[model samples]
Target: MVKKKPTNKDDNLVAQNRKARHDYRVLQTYEAGIALTGTEIKSVRASRVNLKDGFAQIRDGQATLMNVHISEYEQGNQFNHDPLRNRKLLLHKQEIKRLAKETDKKGVTIVPLKMYLKKGFAKVLIGVAEGKHEYDKRETMKKRDQEREISRVLKHY
Candidate 1:
């Protein structure tokens, strides 16, 4: 039996960090290309990317993605990429400087939100975010609950 390959649109998304939305107030978003080894790319295409517990930082004038897990490819032997390796993110020089400056501000940080394929190349969606306070989190939950309740009532009517 021949295994079927996933279609372009269906296989675009590799992973997402849903918790980032709930825990941070997003200020801005940027798309960056990830540097991945051959085996890692295969693993990502197999839907083995994980964005939870991941963050980005600027070091030595470069942006690096840390703690994002890309599992080893099953068919790859000793050439498999490390699952926990810090990956480089490709960005323009000015963008990297800007991110570095912004992240230096109190309560601001860089976070990876999602990984997806664009034109067959892997790309990451990163956000400039501020950590949400406890009360702010509560307010977000309340708003969400109200929205849900309103939708339910409208559907019933």
Candidate 2:
């Protein structure tokens, strides 16, 4: 029998952490599997999730994403999962070890970059990031302003 094509509902991007890019220097990225409930998945599909203040922790050989909120489903009834529950993130043993070592560095953190569905399963793109210093943030702002100014001048000319 021929294999059927996968559907897009399970492959769409539900939400993203746009602030992550601006606040940290992303050093490495890893795709991780997230354990989600039916209601939570539905809520994610509706784009009712937030990862702005979310973070991942390595605990007892597992990665858990905390503070990530997925709103309760409209018709979920009493079985709806907690909006801010800590969700398990699936990663390989070796990957988790690497992440643990990296996070041991001062100011390094595991930040969720985006959440999407792949092959009918929810996946999170996690980043090994280091927080940007004040000077670094100021430099980034200066560069952004310069680019905006150049764009404005070109448009007027």
Candidate 3:
């Protein structure tokens, strides 16, 4: 029996929204700090975050992350933060203002794409994305399939 070493370089990635790519055309991406309680931070460190339904919204000139589920910490008794609570995103005022202005345009919104820890600080990658239509999604799928087929043919040859 051979033992394997734990050498996952991308293990720091807490969560990713795979559907975001298929459903939206990303225009821009921004990294923002997340405000978390002690227990919430612990949960995030444990990779207990879900970005599938997460999104960012600007309100009163501030950005907030909503629908990001962070499971409760096991050791947390009564001090655990709410799993689905809206958490504030740390961004400069200028950036917030720009995001607010850009989000006002039709079909453009903020979506959380990935979450990870950078230098021990929890950070989220949010994107300004435009929603894709059904035909656009189909076209993307077709392109991906063609790429896969080409790779297979090359390998066989």
Candidate 4:
């Protein structure tokens, strides 16, 4: 039988913060629109962005994305955006209110897990996560290792 090698995501993936998944137990996920400048758009098209260490904050009934890194556009001199800027996250007032209410619970957070261009518009996938205890994290790792081991066995047999 012919076997096909496993493949990762396409190279067009802009940025991902894997740690967010490990450190927090994601309860729900939301796709949010981001406001970007021209230079920021160019930088995103080049895949020059980072979602690591990025998070969403709720303030004054609004949502803001903090610590997202968008590299400077090479062709745009003196008009590039700040690499790490707090940008507005576009969501309905009701959604924002819901997120804010949920986030008020201790140890629950708004984490930006991914950034990518979807259907010609930039989007951020934010996770509403609750902090995981050390034991929980270890259990997750153990389960992942078991899955990997099972996959390896199946591949060999």
Candidate 5:
């Protein structure tokens, strides 16, 4: 019997924005550390985060994550953080400059794809994306269905 070494890619995944892929064509991805308060970090560790309506923006030479919700910790009481506060994303100045330039293009934006814990710190995977048209989305769905059918048929052989 052979054992496979576990991959750490998603071992600590806290939240994911599945809709981001469907709505946008990702051009590039960057891993960034996120700033979180004590209660916010606790809530994130509990997997109480949402990336559905989240987006990232580069402002004043810094990257900020906006509209993401990290639910308040149940036991935080008076120290609980706001669920929808904008949080800073830790990225190098060069990366932030590049992202800012990329987003200057029409229809291109930065979005949070996933959040996970790395080395005891919270991290976010942000993507540079261009919005997909309706027809593009339909085509992608059709192609996915075709691939699924092909795999199913091959498995039966």
Candidate 6:
């Protein structure tokens, strides 16, 4: 008899870029597999990953993730991988072309919203986003505050 693996959503989440939604208006999101070295995978599983300041790009018909940091494994000596190296994202050709087209627009770029492990493999949720102006950000904050106030009032009833 084989033991079944427990499925927990939060447990699988490795890292998230909290500021991604605040700074940019995400238009679309794509789930792409990431290619990580042995040590890098080990570091990711240990929750030593940072998605802040990370972005994705399509170049030469390939999707690449950049600026994401996966801390070096403490147990890994000379074979440890570089933390800041650009890692390839495994996406379909159609998806790559779509992302490339979307990024070609002004003020539009690709950002990594979060990184998680799925089926024991590292996956990144990348978004095509446009920069949010100061006023837009303020509006979003105002709306959120209003919603919170409404919920609080309802709960008191």
* Cα deviation of 57, candidate 2, in Å: 0.6
lDDT of model 6 at position 55: 93
Tens digits of per-residue lDDT for model 4, 110-139: 999888777678888899999899999999
Which candidate number has the best lDDT?
5
What is candidate 3's lDDT per residue for 104-153, written digit by digit as tens?
99999999999988778899989999999999999999999999999999
Locate the minimum summed-lDDT window of 10 residues in model 5. 4-13
Candidate 5 lDDT tens digits, 16-115: 9999999999999999999889999999999999999999988899999999999989999999999999999999989999999999999999999999
Candidate 6 global TM-score:
0.93
Clashing pairs for model 4 are none
- Over 111-137, each residue of candidate 2 has an lDDT whose tens digit, in order, gives 999998877688899999999988999
> Runs in model 1 with CA error above 4 Å?
1-11, 155-157
TM-score (all chains, Cα) for each model: 0.90, 0.86, 0.90, 0.86, 0.93, 0.93
Q: What is the C-alpha RMSD of each candidate to the true structure, in Å?
A: 4.4, 3.5, 4.5, 5.4, 2.7, 1.9
* Regions more than 4 Å wrong, model 3: 1-11
Model 5 residue 80 CA deviation (Å) reads 1.2
Q: All models: lDDT?
A: 0.93, 0.92, 0.93, 0.88, 0.95, 0.94
Model 2 lDDT at residue 37: 93
Report model 2's TM-score to 2 decimal places: 0.86
lDDT of 1 by residue, 1-157 (tens): 9997656533588898999999999999999999999999999888898899999999999999999999999999999888999999999999999999999999999999989998888999999999999999999999999999999999999
- Per-residue error for 36 in candidate 4, Å, reads 0.7
Candidate 1 to truth, TM? 0.90
Q: Which pairs in model 3 have colliding backbones?
A: none
Candidate 5, residue 15: lDDT:
95
Order of models, best lDDT first: 5, 6, 1, 3, 2, 4
Task: Give the local distance difference test score of model 5.
Answer: 0.95
lDDT of 6 at 1: 100
